[model samples]
Target: MTNPTNLTPSAFTGARRVATALAIGVLTGLAQAGALEVLVLDKEGKPVPDAVVIVVPSGLGVAKNPPPMAAVVNQEKMQFLPPVSVVALGAKVRFSNNDAWDHHVRLTAPGTAVSANPASAEGMSLRLEGKTAGKPAYSAVLTMDKPGATGAVLLGCFIHGSMSGHVYVADSPWTVKTEANGIAVLEDVPEGSATAKVWHAAQVVDKTPQTLVVGSTPAKLTLQLDVVPKRRRG
Candidate 1:
């Protein structure tokens, strides 16, 4: 009985509001019984942490939004908000700096590394021009033109070497980033064997497909992902 779109935060921008509205409509239409709730679990069975879970319907029932003119990745406190991002193919992303200093944004071609790769080719890099405190956020737009493309783009600040984030590009709009509670909900899944993929940084914990069956009543599903500690190298 919870309104999915109602969960949006007050800080949501115009585009986010639009996206949330569309997502709610799509989810409402796909509500049904017999839905499978999946848990993306590690080998130990605890909830996998910080993983993005995406549900792609087998049928062509999902609506597609026209690629937006631009997309934005905000910079604040020498860090990227939403450290992990997933956007549709051909969409553009704008890098916005909220901090007083400048930020250098970079990206990698989709599907380059498994997130743990030591060396990966840099996709592209750009700097965000600074803005006054009261001015609207300044953004650098990056377009994703290639279809069937997926990858994690690393973002960093020139002033802060330790700052980094990931930009995940997918072919569809079913992508959902995990929350602090470690839950990524994909609503309006069609009735059939649909595949839901979960990715953390560059590591793919759940590439295996999950089956979703839709009916007349609302369906609930749960997925679990494992968070493995990064191995240190000399």
Candidate 2:
């Protein structure tokens, strides 16, 4: 992934699109361009059924209709609106606080991962922007140059220590959150044979990586993870 830790918004976006597109194209070529099987689990070998899993081709391919303009993460009840988030490497992440109280949101500890570019952090903050419902939202955009998983982005408020959530940046559209049954299927992976990786926010980093090959018909990959609690409303 290309890292734009120091570039301005316009420069960063242009650089990111080119880098991500090229990488996706390469991987798409190497891959049969078929469906992929994804499995999620915890450190204890139990099924992590509800986590989000995504697969970005190690290289670039034909870009899908660019996704919607931007996605959002909200702050409500002193917690992040959604505990889990997924985005393409060059997409925008908007942060909006809908709670009755004010919260300070910042990315104190950026994630670390190997990227095609070595001069900048693959992950960075556009800025510490804030938002409120009934008002305009605040946002920042980050780009990743390589296709791989990352640690976690730590979001916190000096006013509310418990407010937190995870942001996942993927290189491909092959990403999905698992159902309650602990299964997530990545449709249209390169057919034939390839390796697939599973990730979760509630467990150790990439604790369970599975490999599978797609055939003429769709493929089914089943996985398990240790049990964990989903987000609940108070």
Most accurate candidate by TM-score:
1
For candidate 1, write residues 45-114 as lDDT tens digits: 5455446666666654553332233566788877777676666666677778888777777665444532
The models' CA-based lDDT, in order, is 0.59, 0.57
**Roughly what TM-score does model 1 have, to 2 decimal places?**
0.64
What's each prediction's TM-score? 0.64, 0.61
Could you give the C-alpha RMSD of every candidate to the true structure, in order shown? 13.1, 13.7
Count clashing pairs, candidate 1.
22
Task: Identify the candidate with maximal lDDT.
Answer: 1
Off by over 4 Å in 1: 1-50, 63-70, 109-121, 132-137, 202-206, 211-222, 229-234
Clashes of each: 22, 29
lDDT of 1: 0.59
- lDDT per residue as tens, model 2, 91-195: 556777665556665553244644322253443333334455577655444443334533345556767777667666554566666665667766655555555
Error of 2 at 184 (Å): 2.4
Residue runs of model 2 more than 4 Å from their true location after superposition: 1-33, 36-50, 56-69, 108-151, 226-234
